[model samples]
Target: MRRRAVVAAAAVLTGGVAVLLGVAVPQAQAAEVSYATRCIPPSGIGLPPVDGTTKVEITAPAAAKVGDTVDVVWTFTQAASRNPDIIDLPADSVQPSGTLKAAGAQSADIAMRGPRQNPPVPKGGAMVLSAMKGSLKLTTAGQVMLTPDAYVVNALSTDTSCAPTQQVQPAATITVTAGSGSSSGGTGEPSHTGTPSHTPTKTTSPSPPASTSTSPSPSGGSGGQTDFTGKVVNVPYTCQSPIGQKRATSPVQINARKNGGSYDLTVQFKKSVMDSPIDIPANSVKPAMQVVLGGADKGSVAVEGPKNAAPIKQGAPIEIPDLTGVYKPGATGEATLSPGVLTIDALGTRTTCTPDSSTVSLTLDTTEQAGGASGATGGSGSSSSTAGGASTSGGLAETGAGDHATLKALGLVAGTAVLLGAAVFTYLPGRRRTR
Candidate 1:
């Protein structure tokens, strides 16, 4: 009886430690970083003080429900002094945009544009640049996993004419409160099938602290058993640049996977760092970037058990293991995640990629059609319907691999403790009886 009691106590203690490490490490250590854009006015030493003030006001519904189509708009009123060629605010950085239709109040002098022809936006919309007031509208109609999130819309000025730019002080704040309705198109409480307490909040604000509360489930993947093969991710980029189409770099395939099942997927990925020059049109007043990330890496993410699937109900975050970031110089003279890693938005070219093993090969196929260059100078203006590549700061929260290893080490310690207790209990009592 005493031996049995001893074994039981140790087992409980070890199990407790195992569970605690698994829960606490990931929840506490995962980087809760948020990134955003800050515009800077030009500072000239010898030239005239070309002071420009660009004020932005966001008009959005205080709260929105999933499935309900709504319009979230941004109104930009540029001061008379500044002639900004491109004003960028990432739509996803602001809120959970569904069918967003962002537009800039049509302008005669400045046309909306980006560094790459196609900027990254989940919901399709064009960010435009006009001299006066321009607007951007996005929708969160069908997305279900939204929660109460505060958005910080950073104002960015990327003009060849703005010569030198600096960070805008006191960034604007916007709140998007997630409410539950219809499982279909109505709003309701956030589903909590053990979903993360802190949702993705990078670029604008630090993610909320995760609940220390634990809710463990049995060893079984969630329902909706689906097997996806060759889940190739396609990260959105210009695919072709505006100024130099032929000079455009190729798309780097950072990661790829083939789902064995929901939780049992096999993945191959790489993480490399590189520095390249930012693109600038010849006629545009802006100069090329000083340095940008340019390189490739090897190795991918590691997956733990109990996986979930798409349209994942019950509120758990869709964690794509092995999260990483691609650092680059921002439009406003700052370093930010050009293509943030491990985010639902950065989930990559989720549109069923080209089937193949591990290898990235593609040319800079210039999608640069005939269009007017944006600057303070003269040119014929043309409009396109794609998201321009002028990136405003944005980011995604991620739990690093080191955190995962710590949890595993704790589990191993617990398992060893349990075994040691059982062995000692059996041998010591038996030896006493024999003596």
Candidate 2:
């Protein structure tokens, strides 16, 4: 009886400890942070600020223990700006102990257009510059996991051009009060709570897996999906003039898929600008304007003249140079399992006098499925459609490889955690008896 009692007690204690630790082990230790920044502007700084309003929103983790560092990031957008240029903000520095919920760092950049573009230059549209800005604060309980050495914040553009840039003063410490870590009955500010009561904010907003709606079933491969019937239109531009025109010829085809099952789909596209030198001759003025149009995702147009040059009267002729021969051409699209919609926009610039290309826009009709095999397995499938008074169909849509790989990895991580948890609960008590 005593032996049984001893075993029982041991089992209960072991289970209790395991459960507590298990809860703690996965109870994400993170830091919650928030901040707001504004540009001190004189309106024109020679570098020509992005021709419109800009805004940024940052949501850090809620809290961390003593030594576990969490990642911090900033997401910025050019709210209603015409010129999809860059905006600069302060970087994060080493926080004084106790000043931060976690000891990681902070960072950011001009948002890049997409994964396809490396050293991702800002697509002229708002995009996440850096996946992670800097290191984070964390608990020193077991192994002290420190944050990265440095974070990359961005620099502000001058009124004249984006080439010559200026860096802003970065902030080092994250402010936290004593009783603020918890989501409720707490100050809502993040703080270090030694016990396992903190939840780490997901590093970098949880961007949905870049899935497509073109596939038949949610499980099929990228190629076995339907292609949208549409022509690619090029936005025209002109150097040194405000008047421009657009061509309805040389249309490109669009292909896509829907994740999950929904009707509203979002679109994304890449944008690039031409590097040209302006020749408005100092003091001489022409009503030069920048116009961005198309789609429900993001669009804007701005007209700015040289400082001291005569202001461009509304409805004035804005010359736009033709870009008939530029830009790569192809029918690109994908299929998604998650279902829903996503709209992506990109930006580029023209150095001298030229028109920026109209970003490729894809409206993923998330509600339709062409065949029997739902592209759910990430396998192959097929799609059928009617284009130009004829039957059109497609196969083998490659879900952007980078996107596919990332989603697969995330699934593996989650599965491993579940297995580990089941083992701990199922085997620990039996082993305690033998001990």
Candidate 3:
């Protein structure tokens, strides 16, 4: 079988801020440029992986709505720490570049906007969210799918894009998988870990909504619960990507072992990643990982499936790759599952593989309508009750919740003062929050 090489066209990034932010719609005020790269499985022909034994990881929500503030993090590994002190490799030396295209090509587009921060060049370890804080905004609700034509471009000099001994992984894609559901949270500066914490500091963007968003009721689980103590399992996952252009799925292998109270998560990809490796730049770095966990059982039980979806649920630890160790494996996914029940347990194991900010949620799609479950799929069933977490306010992802509610209270105070001087007028402060 003749392998086809996936190539990249290095074009001067255009459109200025408007294009960069994807603010092509009338609703958008501003936008920012987002990053992307193409990483095909080793079976498929593509660019070789980076030489530094590095991996580039990008994280964002599985689904977003119009006016939603989506937080995007792109992590890279830096060489500043390994060989310290004197200036060696310069900054912005390595770029995993690409263009973002939404599925169905709606009239509106997803804008990459606001307060973009440069990730710190770590002296050692992996560089995280503090590294790249790119916010995503949807202009059209109809735009559900996203595909980025990702490719790498190294600025350093070399006879070719690769060196004789550098490790190389093929450019993979960053896509929205599983159900297209949105999440709610506050924004924060990304660090070398790329993980978003519970309560992040405030950003210039608008605050999160007062009420949390909810999602579909937690449904039945496909069976396969495992106690992955010193074991490895090859898990098959299905996601929608490469839309008409390319369709591929990496063979996933999960390596888990009990570590004291929690299970350690390690993963490997068969015939995946850049075939070999590429040269590592002077001071730049690649991603190690950003782990994602979800489902109703947050213990040693890991729910493995698509985003906003679940066909299989079992006991296993989750993992996100990082630059802290040799990231030889291919790559994992970000937005491929649904909002069942999720929590991070990466208290130990790897340091840089922090809990990722990627989130999926279940909403109050229905209530007990004085009737029992219809006992039918997609029916008016009473059993499929959604435990509400749906966000009422149209807040941005990663932004702390409740601030919008606080702002609403303040607005109410002002209204109350005016009402006292006149009639007893009723007001709903947070009504206008969700766009």
Candidate 4:
């Protein structure tokens, strides 16, 4: 009897130590809930509202202490709905972002971002969205209920805001308690913080070997044509968008080859500078670059590339294809080339990016051909002129306080949907609330 008693005492002490060390904690079971949702299209677009069912499975920790940050994951299964228009949505284009309403111990809404859909969405086909993940820090100690809230789907640059039409059941619930004197071993930061937390990395592309050749000049004389290869330049750019100003470094590869009277220029972006916030339709994005010229030339030249052949999904890298243009030497000698401004046009919206500094990428030694062209012209069928000449044909979209206000309103709607879902689930028997 004494030996049994001693064993029991040892077991109790071991369990206590495990609790203090945050070991042997019970895992929270996932809970599934379904709710009716109504999505309203942007006003003045003359599109009717959409109604469907949304099923969500949420997983979270069963208990947490104050100041402890816990992970929350939500997987959504959207009801089948036909597309309203004939458009091609590229793979990973549909992105879902919304809020999770928290009640009881915490009243703040938690924002969530889901992964992009994998399959392409064809015209009049069913839409598929992916799973969402978020995190929250326990503040007040109590039972907190998390419910699905309003969400938004950005497809082909259009915002379709959605909410639950009926009462929503809570997807999960988390029990919060006072923090222990020791650390909880939790990450201090939340996963989703409204803005992206990615850092841009510098990248370079390999260059080709330099070569020299001769071509017949416009004046019937032999002109020396040289090819400058393997030039990589990194330019810092600031881009203005609906969200805010985003800064990144774009690595550019430049190659110049003298062809008779003019120099053939090719510029390629080694790395993408920004991510697309919404799905971009095929052939919707047109990219252009302004190349600064020196030495033999004094002004900048405009180069244009073809429209994107495939659809660009939301959150994916926005890539600009190779830009080609022709530059005619004005005075001869050695000419210098550098990257300047970059412009992107999506649908009707224009995004202009200005480089902080122009780094010289290529230089070519040449003799001016008689009766050669004077300014720069696009090689790929794009109309362009010098810096002091006619501007590119495109109007900038209006953006300001209105865009910010719209985003806030959408967030509130998402929060409300979450709260309603939680309240409905509380009344159902055998259904536990989740956060």
Could you tell me how far off, in angstroms, the CA of residue 121 lies in candidate 4 after the best superposition?
Answer: 1.3
List model 2 lDDT by residue over 1-435, tens digit each. Answer: 999999999999988998987643333234322232222222211121222222333334444444334455433332212212221111221010111122323221212111111133221323233332334433222222222111112221111111112222222234332332232221122433111111211211123333332323322223455334222333222211011111111112233333333221222111211111111112222122222222221222222322223322222221212211001111123322111111101011111223224434334322223321232211111112101112111000111223111111111111111111111111111122111
Top candidate by TM-score? 4
Q: Cα miss at 101, model 4 (Å)?
A: 0.8
Candidate 3 local lDDT, 229-289, one digit each (tens): 1111122121111110111122223333322222234433222122111222211211122
Q: Give the TM-score of candidate 4.
A: 0.42
Q: Candidate 3: which stretches are off by over 4 Å?
A: 1-56, 76-87, 90-97, 104-137, 152-435
The residue-by-residue lDDT of candidate 4 on 1-435, one tens digit each, is 999999999999999999899887757858988998777654433244656677888888988888777888877765424443223355764667777777776666778888756576554456667777888878777787888787766543445677889998888999887885233423233434232233321222223233323222322223443565636765666545432344445567777665655667788765454455444457766767778766665566678788889866556655667888876665566666788777766434344566667777876665665543335443222355333232232222221223211111111111111111111111112222221
Cα-based lDDT for every prediction: 0.21, 0.23, 0.24, 0.57
Ranking by lDDT: 4, 3, 2, 1
* Alpha-carbon shift of residue 153 in model 2 (angstroms): 7.1
Clashes of 3: 78
Q: Lowest-lDDT window of 10 residues in candidate 1?
A: 406-415
Q: Which is superior by TM-score, 1 or 2?
A: 2
Better of 1 and 2 by lDDT: 2
C-alpha displacement of 156 in model 3, angstroms?
7.5
User: Candidate 4, which segments miss by more than 4 Å at Cα?
Assistant: 1-24, 79-82, 181-435
Model 3, residue 88: distance off in Å is 3.6
